[model samples]
Target chain A: MADTLNPPGQVPVTVLTGYLGAGKTTLLNRILSENHGRKYAVVINEFGELGVDNDLVVDTDEEVFEMNNGCICCTVRGDLIRIVNGLMKRRDKFDGIIIETTGLANPAPVAQTFFVDDTVKEKTRLDAIITVVDAKHLPQRLIDSAEAEEQIAFADVIVLNKVDLVSPDELAEVEAQIRRINKYAKIHHATKGNVSITELLDQGAFDLNRVLVHAPDFLTSDEHEHNDEIRSMSFEAEQPIDAERFNAWIGALLAEKGGDMLRTKGILSYEGDDRRFAFQAVHMMADGDFIGPWKDGEKRVSRIVFIGRNLNRPQLRRGFESCQVA
Target chain B: MSETADKVLQTRGKTRELDAFVVKASFDRSGSACAFALGDGEVAILRQGADDWQRIRAHEGAVLALATDAAPQGWISGGDDGRFYRIQPDGTVALIAPFGMRWVENVTSFTDGARTRLVACSAGKKLAVFNAQDEELKVFEHPSTVTGMVFDGKGKRVAASHYDGASVWLVASRSDTPRRLEWKGSHIGITMSPDGDNVVTSMQENSLHGWRLSDNQHMRMTGYPSKTQALSFTRSGKWLASSGADSVVLWPFFGGGPMGKPPTELAGGDGINCTYVACHPKDDLVAAGFADGLVVIADIASARILPVAGPGRGPISTLAWSPDGAHLALGSESGFAAMVDLSKK
Candidate 1:
């Protein structure tokens, strides 16, 4: 089961993140203590100073540092590249890696490292970005800092921790708040980071089927829209899109609005094609491939979800509709 | 300068009409021929003739790995199709091993006197060794999936680099225990010195780690701006040239070893980082490819660099010196290739 889930040759890397006091350490400790029959190399902040129970705990002292002013993308990534690579040299040491980013840290640069670097890309696959939100304070934290909102937007799975501290209605409100920024991320309710090991690992959130399965109506929900500048816009088309036209439109759109577009994903049904085209974009980079043929009884449809700022829903809708096979 | 350029023979442009992403390049034993694996699972083998290369549909998917065949005239390649094959200089291909549906990560073959052994690593954490007859010899399982593999100089042993370190296995007999060279970290590339006295690995952490075979003494070479993806040792094993920064750093492996000796930095500046390097099979000259898609040949004693390939293709992905040291074959990520003949100079 350990090697079956992840493709052979490449190791799965899980980015574990949470705002301050959201029980990230507790979740990390739980992942470490669980008898999951797997080894994890945990990269925590100031690991050398803190005594963690894990045998393979690596202390990374903010390896990502700013090299220039106003450029949020300067973290050397070479540090994590070094650690992940160093961990790779001892191939027998661990099965997977868990990188726990700091509370205030934005996960964008970290995620970009996996995409931008070739050496890191060959040996490791980013399994998922798991964000553990402080259920009690996330409401205000989202408004207080952009870092918190960015983390929620980039997450593949959101663990709303400390549910006991908030009422059920409050919990629903927090869930609604998270949905406004990222409707694609799988959300789980937890009181003390008590979540199943299966929910965290081997979650092919990056896979098109698994991504679209959990959030079937993500792009259609209007009530969950957030007031903050960040918003999630989901779109669906009943008719299949002309693959070439759709590609050109998206390419031009990302080129013009990529700076504001945080993350975009879609499972598109194309004309003259039985297989579904699964696409995802991070900033300016986008990649898509055919997943599989639509089931015999399944309805053919195209759905897309974008999380970003100042999104002109009407304009984007018109642009996507124009790509339909004409 | 133009007169000097006229002395070196250069063949440029795409080997085939179709665009491809060149994954790797290799030279046969005599250095008279070369092979380049494409992203679409096809291979283009070029002989000594002028632009004499033909494309072969080598696999069903992208061909990711290629190694010089144990024989003197062919190559061994593995693909994402989960199959490994042996391609002769004449375009003849044979399946060496099949691994159900797993991607074949790497393949390396070595010739020991009369016997030739071909080893292939699959995505399923298994290494299958085959004899010259192409019969399966033995399959060894690793704690993790193997990243890279190489055969020692004598062809008696093969080392497979994986999670913790590398495992050195004896190909002649199955009873011998694989000596585990443990240096904790992800080791992507592995190479054994020509003399078989030292084995070094290019770590995921922008550095290199080596071991002296006799006493298992560890050698650490660190502090690079980027991850070192390419490594090459001189014919005499006196120097180890690696790519990590704008230039190639050649570490002195003689006398007191690379321990405290200051490395000789060659052909670096601006923002261009070396992506691959290859030492002449018989000379002190080394060929280095940069991230800017340029290939330069550097002389050890003279410290002079000659531009063999120009910029504008893509990052140079692979470089290899022909056996006679007369030609240097270079490939780029953009599926372009060029061969520079040094004999004319």
Candidate 2:
């Protein structure tokens, strides 16, 4: 990730994506009219075109511009590039660009804009990709729609908005689905956009360092085979991971067949002492973190998750628990 | 809980972004024990005790294993570089032996026990033994990754637990076969009672096992809500404490006899799992680190938690008391190793 100099000059792109009826626009209105002074140039593909009632969540301005292209991932991606490029040309005209995508856009292609495209990425960096999901409908969406799947898959941050209507069990299901799609994204539950908008913008999200640290277990390179039911599970134990056995076990597990591992993250704790150890893994890469000393009254626990289609829970559980002093 | 923490350590040379290099490994004490292994088959040791600690080039290639022997002043280290070294009191690291292996991960030194022994295990099944003098005494092969190894009381027998299974191998004497204690499935933790009569282990099988070494019988402790990791025994070996799911469980060790139900229990922080448990070497006081960074010390007798705060908010990884049992040394995932002296701090 490139460093920002003028920082304010760096364009902020807000991605609104989530399962249907996720109150994304309700949240967007708050971002647009919030007491903040920063000037924002809004980009919405289906903003007014969708014909949803404006009565529910009011828009900041009727100065809405629609994209002729389809979803943000396909046609509007280039259009987004051109629009952002043209806007940046004007001096201090717009401080940032906030784009709201249809609930179905796979953010990968949209995210690829900053990394792949040369011109638009250079002028305007991705600020935040926000996804709003229907708290009540998450379970059905996960069980039904592929678009709803991608909406969560590529979220920079997630807002599980409209918690007043959904039950705790439903919320848990929604969260589980979100975690299943993208485990690294930080999800904050909110009752509308009642949450603070300060955390929304200028967060420097397209920042890969923190995201990468969160997802040491993401295996992007290896493609999944036919089977898909096998989900990668994670287990964290606050016990001292016999360092020697852990390294060897992970190395061999990856060496023998990392392609099948899916992903794993472990915050490890050892016996006889109080410290937390963090470890993560993808197909070929594995790393660790000695976060610091464990807090007072804190238990030494290592939380590990392994995601994959054909994950052998029995085998993984055995290997994972074996990490301690045993 | 610091007003501010200075960057006491960093890489000698900057190569890439600081965030990506989040300092994965960290160890510190009033000793020269912190080290990193290089892929070039060598290792560099940095003394965390001294501020201006000089870097000591150790091993030929990627340093694989390191340990502070029973003597807190001296150190023993091994590496994939095929060389081992011993740091004497004079600040000199002398090459002690050669072990040509892919990599060695841990060095378990129990040289002070009645039958002194040093054991090291590598990435695969490579296991080697050494005398107190650092001589290679023996080598054996295992089927899976050998993750856990420890010397039972008096160091008469050496037991190594595996990722898939667990076993106890006798050291000092050569011809006797290792007494086998099998806990199939994802087995994570293992600990022996001070009397060397009972053993407690955490399993990935969603259960815990208590084995009586005297009779070779075992009892599976169940009803855990989730995965548990920490296990410890009282100095007298009468009380066995195992923390798991959401509480610290205490079961009497009657030479692996039937533990129909736990005799005592210590409740954990709400919603946070108790991950590790350390019984005071000489007392019934127990420490448990939780998932949310709550380190609660509980009384095994009263089942009341004493406020022996943990090291940091991060998951506490290791909690070691000084030989005198006055100071609690804590290690963490964030590269913070702290010594909380009961008398001083």
**Predicted candidate 1 versus true structure: per-residue lDDT over B111-198, tens digit per residue:** 7636555655544467788877888886777766676777788877778776667888887675857889988666767888999888
What's the lDDT for all of these models?
0.76, 0.56
Instruction: Assign candidate 2 its CAPRI class.
Output: incorrect
The local lDDT score (0 to 100) that residue B266 gets in candidate 1 is: 92
Model 2: per-residue lDDT, tens digit, A54-157?
Answer: 21121221111212122222211433543443343232445667776666665544554454334454566566677787788777877787667656655657
Instruction: Please list the residue runs of candidate 1 whose C-alpha ends up more than 4 Å from where it truly belongs after superposition.
Output: A1-326, B1-18, B116-124
Q: Indicate the residue-level lDDT of A133 in model 1.
A: 97
- Candidate 1 CAPRI category: incorrect
- TM-scores, one per candidate: 0.58, 0.44
In terms of TM-score, the best-performing candidate is 1
Q: Which run of 10 residues does model 2 chain B get worst, by summed lDDT?
A: B13-22
